[model samples]
Target: MVAPALILVILVTLWPVAQSFYNSLFDYRLTDPSRSERFTQSNIDLERYATEYFYISRDLEDLSAQAPDDETAQAVNDIQTEIEAFHSELIEMDGLEEQYGEVDEMIASFTAISDRDLKYAEVDNDWAEGYKDFLAASNEELIALSEGAPEEDFSTTAGNVAGTLDTINSAVIESNFIGLSNYSRYLQDARMWQSLLNTFIFTIASVAVELVLGLAIAILINRVFIGRGVVRASVLIPWAIPTAVAAMMWGFLYDGQTGIVAHYFEQFGLINDASVLLSTANGGMFSVIFADVWKTTPYMALLLLAGLQTIPGSLYEAAEVDGAGKWQQFWKVTLPLLKSAILVALLFRTLDAFRVFDLIYVLTGGGPANSTESISIYAYITLFSQQNFGAGSVLSVIVFLCVALISTLFIKFIGSDLFEGRSR
Candidate 1:
């Protein structure tokens, strides 16, 4: 019985974690042409760029026909020079494809690191240097393309040259990972620290605001009052609205030119102007956090309200009989009994808030100087925008660990009885 339970835990929880670790050991691309013969076949963007370059070249030719002076001639020449460089780069990229196609030497470098047979420098620099030489060959070809460079010829060639570019990208990643370098890099990395600090500040303030406001709303809704049913629904309106939709709603309201938030803050002298609110570092963070709190406060309230309802009325009545006033009864009887429920709610909401991405993503896009960048948004920018896979993987691990640590600590405070029914 224990064997089956242990196996289940390993499969469900441990395996994927182990796989992330496994992958972290190797520097590889998910879609490296070195791994596939179908790069040109699958890449729609390659063909699209090729077409775009063709059109751009033609547009330049047409513009050149209308040049009125030496200055105009020089400007056209500058633009064409850049375009021609692109053309040459594409042609040379084909040889890069052929070179790294199942590059055993580079693979040996990565494999040696995986097996602990090579030092950091050997795997990172030496192998990367090997890749760079091939890439240089690709760059040289790009240098050779003339004004008569054929666009059709490049569709096939870009896929080839792209292989070397891919290798260079991989090398940049391996350099980030191999030693205590990333830690040093992380320390020196202003953007990373700023984002990390902002995330912490947002997490703390948002969690605090949600809990205080949520408890007040939950207590109010729990009582017998007029329009109780209608009031409950009204209170939940914010929660019922999807986060993305709410974020967008707030985005419009906070829009620089025609936004209500910007207008109000400006009218009341709370902000200097609409652009200032969204563009200033402190104001941007404040706006993002406020928007998140507005959208999600009701969610926290609903959780607390559920816990409040489960507290038996009898306890409060007994407290009243014992000469406890409403406040005292709330403090001694209701609060004590509802501690478990509150803990459960807080645990869920805190974890969710720590991973906040969408609201910040929509409302601010981690900008006006990245003051509102949550870890989730940071991970996204790394993975998708920067396309730095190694750093992104490291960030994913960090996010998971932070959330897990928070949950563990919170659960410990509430005690194991809360989870007694659930087995590992």
Candidate 2:
């Protein structure tokens, strides 16, 4: 019965997470200057190792110059022998890569992909050509070294030669793709953590304001009163507004010179001469939270109202009969009865707050300098803006896990009947 949604959740949520973690290991940025360089970085260590072997081969040439006459030829022979051993080691390393590393394959996969190519490209003919060249060069180097050819015989210098090797290693065409290199690169970046912290601040402040205002309004309307229906309907106006539209409305209101919000706040002495709220960091934060609270509080109120309705009217009557005052009845009876609803409201609002984007975008655009960048916004940036698919995936996967953990914790502590539990 609930299987489809659960399956969909797993597909949409969990599957993406697994994919992101996989990507974070690779340097799979779509827009990086070295789209190929990212792949090179992914295999940096392996490439370095191979180059180290080359350098050692070169150093033996240095040692050859100082050799005594009889042994100089023997030294040449010894260098040849050592070079063969190095080639054997390189082959063993490649075998290990086949069994344990996919640096080359992973790099190829990134280079072979773009907006132009779909997954596992049409013919992969280009990659094949590139692969053949790379392999030939790799084999040529090994052959030359083993043949006791001086390192200077190669077309490129020893230092520059490794870069050519890197180019070959990073040819991660779709067919040859394997390894977790992109994701490892994601962990090394600093901007990701900054965006994460920004998101946390926005979500927490927004949810707190919504919960407090919502509960207050719910209690206000819970009592018997004329025009209560009108009041209740009024409360829903903010919730009824499309989030995008409301975001625009707030954007205008937060405008410095012409905004009514600025005019009124200044008139009331809330600020000295500041005319806009979204320009400053603290102001932008406050504005977004304010807008969020205005839009979502009614939703929180409605959920709490539903819970308020379930409390038998008789419980309040009895509390009054037992000499409990209005505040006493509310504290002793209303709050307890409303626990389930409160939790439900909080869970919904909290999750929504964590994922918030449209409002921040319309209102702040995650600026005056990325101050308001939430995790969701950062994920968007990583995925689309920066085009670092792997890094974006890592951030996205982290968000998924955090949301899942929050939902799970809320259900265990306050929402026991929310996700899976039911009355027997």
Candidate 3:
């Protein structure tokens, strides 16, 4: 029974992370044609190679016949022979001849080779290197010949052939596997470090404020009152709002001009100007933290309220009978019993706060110069906006590590308390 559930957990949780880790090992980017997929060895894009080779072969044959001198004609013929020799070797590779023939036929018929296996073929690393070097040298020679050729048409044709050779060289895709270089690159990236610092600041500040306010609110609601149910329900309204919706609503409230909340803040002297809220780095950070605290404090209060109810009323009564005042009773009885609940609440909130994305994304958009950019937001931009999967995955793995570390520390504290209780 446990095995089945554990297997499910691994499949659902670990599989995606493993896939991301694998992607991080390559220089994967969707925007670049050559690096759109993960390749561990050099390969030829048969579709592009076959099409360009057909035209290049014909052009080279024409150039040799039209050469201005015997030396030029011989150079053209030799370049064509070397290219054909490399091509012959390429098509002879295992399982490539059939695909190459198909691609050639497709090109002749003006049909696209849509199958990936028919469009790309693995080639030996040494062969690819030699082919690329030969093409580069041949292109330079053709360019030099074109510049010195007397006939204008011959000069133009030679330059065009040289351009074709360069294109063919690019068809030889090298391995994109960079191993751990993406991780190392980002380790020195200043933006990555700054974004991480912003994330930590937001998490620590928001969680700390929420904990204090939440505890006070929970204590207030726990006492008997005529409208306690209404009060408790009303307190949850902010948390009940969808985070994106809340963030958008706060966006309006924080607007520099024509915003009621901003006006009130200015009147309260919290800021020198209403526009400063959305236009300055420090102000942007404060705005996000404040909005987060308002939206999440009720959640924190609810969790603590549950823990507060678990404490027997007799304990408080006993403390009072011993002449302990309210503060003394709270410190002696309420706090000690509430340790586990507080830790649990802190764990949940800290993890959630550290991974914050939508709230800050919609609120400040990590702006006023990215003063409030969290690591998650940075990853989202790199992964989606920039289409850089390798670097984005590194950021994602970093977030997972940070969250794991925080959870480990909190669990250790909770576990030690449990062990001590059991021993007692």
Candidate 4:
């Protein structure tokens, strides 16, 4: 039974992480055709190559006939012969001729080759390198001939042929597999480190403030008071609001000229200027942290309240009988008994805070030179905005490792005391 459940857990949790780790091993990017997919071996984009090769052959034939001098004509014929030989060799490979014919038919009919198996054909690494080098040399020669051509038509045709060669060369996709290189590259990236530092600062500052305020709120509301249920319900309103909506609301509140909150903050001497809150790096960081604390503190309070209610009234009474004051009773009785609760609350909040995205994303958008940018935001920009899947996956794997490390530390240190108490 345990084995089956454990297997399910591993499948559900680790599969996506495993996929990301695999992608991080390659130089994958959706924006570039050559790097759109992970290639473990050199491959040819038959669709593109076959389509362009048709035009290239005709263009080179025309150029060779129209060459101004014997030397230019001979150079063009040599380039044409070399390219034709490469194409013949490519089509002669087993299983490629049939696909090449089908791609040729598709091109003739103006149909896109949508099938991957029919589109890309793997080739020997050495052949791919040789073909690419030859294409480069031919292009350079054609470019020189075009520049020095006596007639405008000759120059234009030569330049167009050279451009066609470049297009064909791009169709020859090389293997993008570079194991652990993305990780090493990002490890030395200053922006990555800065984003990480910003994440840590936001997590530490918000969680610390939330813990303190939450504890105080929990203690205050735990005592018998007027309309306690209403108070508790009201306190949860901030947490109950959707985070995006709350962030938008705060954005309005933090606006320099029109926001009441910023106006009040400036009036209270908290800031030198109202516009500083969103215009400066430190202010952007503070703005997000402050918004996060306001949004999450109620949740922390609610968790602590559950723990507070679990403590018996007898403990407090006993402390009082022993001549203990309120603060002493709290330290001696309340705090000691609330250890497990505090641990649970802190662990949950810390992990959540560390991976914070939506709140900060909507609040600051990681702007003001990315002072408020978290690891998640950086990963988002890399993965979606820039469309660099490999580098983005590297950042994601780093976040997972950091979260794992945090969990280990919390369980090893804070949880040890709770487990020991239970054993005792």
- Candidate with top lDDT is 3
Stretches > 4 Å off in candidate 1: 1-16, 26-180, 421-424
Candidate 4 residue spans exceeding 4 A from truth:
1-13, 414-424
Selected candidate, larger lDDT, 3 vs 4: 3
lDDT of 1 by residue, 178-277 (tens): 4334345555777777777888899889888988898888888787788877866876788888888888898888888989888988899988777776
lDDT of 4 by residue, 266-335 (tens): 9999999999999999999989999999999999999999999999999888888999999998899889
lDDT at 100, model 4: 89
C-alpha root-mean-square deviation, each candidate: 13.3, 9.5, 2.8, 3.1
Model 3 scores a TM of 0.94
lDDT of 1 at 181: 42
Error at 214, model 4, angstroms = 1.0
Arrange candidates, best lDDT first.
Answer: 3, 4, 2, 1
Top-TM-score structure, candidate number: 3
lDDT of 3 by residue, 1-424 (tens): 7899999999998998998888999999999998998899998998889889989989999999999989999999999999999989887888788878888888999998778877888999999999999999999999999999999988999999999999999999989999999999999999899999999999999999999999998998897779877877787899888999999999999998987899999999999999999899998999999999999999999999999999999998898899999999989999999999999899889999999999999999999787889999999999999999988999999999899999899988888764554576
Instruction: Flag the better candidate by TM-score, 1 or 3.
Output: 3
RMSD of 3: 2.8
**For residue 382, what is the lDDT in candidate 2?**
71
lDDT (CA) per prediction: 0.64, 0.65, 0.92, 0.91
Better of 2 and 4 by lDDT: 4
Whole-model lDDT, candidate 3?
A: 0.92
Q: Give the clash count for model 1.
A: 6
TM-score of 1: 0.63
